[model samples]
Target: MDKNILGNNVITQIGILVHDIEKTSQAYADFFGIDKPDWSMTDTADIAQTEYRKQPTQARVKLAFFDMGSLQLELIEPDHNPSTWREYLNEHGEGPHHIAFVINGMKGKVAMMERNQMPLLQKGEYTGGRYAYMDTFNDLKIILELLEND
Candidate 1:
């Protein structure tokens, strides 16, 4: 594993795909003895552009974040449509979807992953950052998300 390819080995988030964001978030909060989590829906415009399985598409998701000191716990609820989260939930049910790492050199790292035979599954932009999800489920049994924030 080239260190420069993926930047540092610091995981910033653990994302889970769920059927219901509110319910799942409440469950997590209850189990962890924390307050109810607030869910935020992704803005349509903020996505800018999106691609799934190399095809242009639309994926709406409601998200909730829980801070756990170093890493964040992210819950994702997919709209009743075709999306990565929906596909994951339909195929594997509710569970861990991906592990995200904050990378400074996002574009370079994405290129390196491509060179290493990891296909990009999806890519999108948010308010102050962008993210790319790589297909590593077969090899690592988990998707890898590379995020770059401004």
Candidate 2:
């Protein structure tokens, strides 16, 4: 009768918001001694079906990822859209955004999180999977992202 909402405690990724992804990614690469990874933009709202605080919105971001052993470090540059990424960037400047976990049963996980008072801030679908951001900062000191690959 008891289970963690994420199903496990393994953090698969750490998402960082940046004003300039290219510069940040390069900095990470140089610091880590790895090649700078290419960045891509998130799909438009039509494709991603992005929702921010229950309203559908055209929010997208430039994204780049660095494979760091078992965890991936993500750099995100938001477009001025009404989205989690943009909001976080505007409010906090450039900094860490969310800690992500790969999980199954997206609906169940989201419901559990909401019941625990951590409401969903945003959600969207990508090519092969979907992601949800939970408002866990007050309790966990950080936002949490649930990634469900299908």
Candidate 3:
């Protein structure tokens, strides 16, 4: 198998696209015997800077983060916008959407992935961090997310 752009194989998060954040989060919590995940909506100001298919576009999602030991489980509910989460839900239904790796040089790693034929799908910033999703489903059978915490 090919090594990742960062030369590390650690997956920090597994993201799931869902139609309803509350329902899916509860199901995951019950299944894993954990407390309900905390929910947050993407800020409107940040949505303006989001990019989809390499163009600045508007997208919003409701997110729920569940801490599971060393990894995090993220539930995403697309909020009436064209985004990676919505595309996944439309094409594949609700399930695993992406596997994310936290890296140091996020821009360099993202460029490497793009050079390797994994074009960027979407990107946005959040508190203390930013992320980019790559279209690597054909090769890896799942989207790959690159995260950088500042």
Question: Which one wins on lDDT?
Answer: 2
Indicate the TM-score of model 1: 0.92
RMSD of each: 1.6, 1.3, 1.8
Q: lDDT, candidate 2, residue 108? A: 91
- Strongest candidate by TM-score: 2
Residues 1-67, model 2: lDDT tens digits = 2357788999999999999998999999999899999999999889999999999998889999999
Candidate 2 error regions (>4 Å): 1-3
Steric clash pairs (candidate 1): none
Candidate closer to the true structure by lDDT (higher is better), 1 or 2: 2
The positional error of residue 80 in candidate 2, measured at the CA in angstroms, is 0.6
The residue-by-residue lDDT of candidate 1 on 1-150, one tens digit each, is 444577688999999998888888999999999998789987673354766777766777899999999999999998865667778889999999999999887778888888877878888888899999998787778999999999
My TM-score estimates for the predictions, one after another, are 0.92, 0.97, 0.92
Model 2: worst 10 consecutive residues (lDDT sum): 1-10
lDDT against the true structure, each candidate: 0.85, 0.93, 0.85
Residue clash pairs of candidate 3? none
34-121 per-residue lDDT for model 3 (tens digits): 8896799887745447888877767888999988889988888987777888888998999999999988887888888888888899
* Alpha carbon lDDT at 90, candidate 1: 94
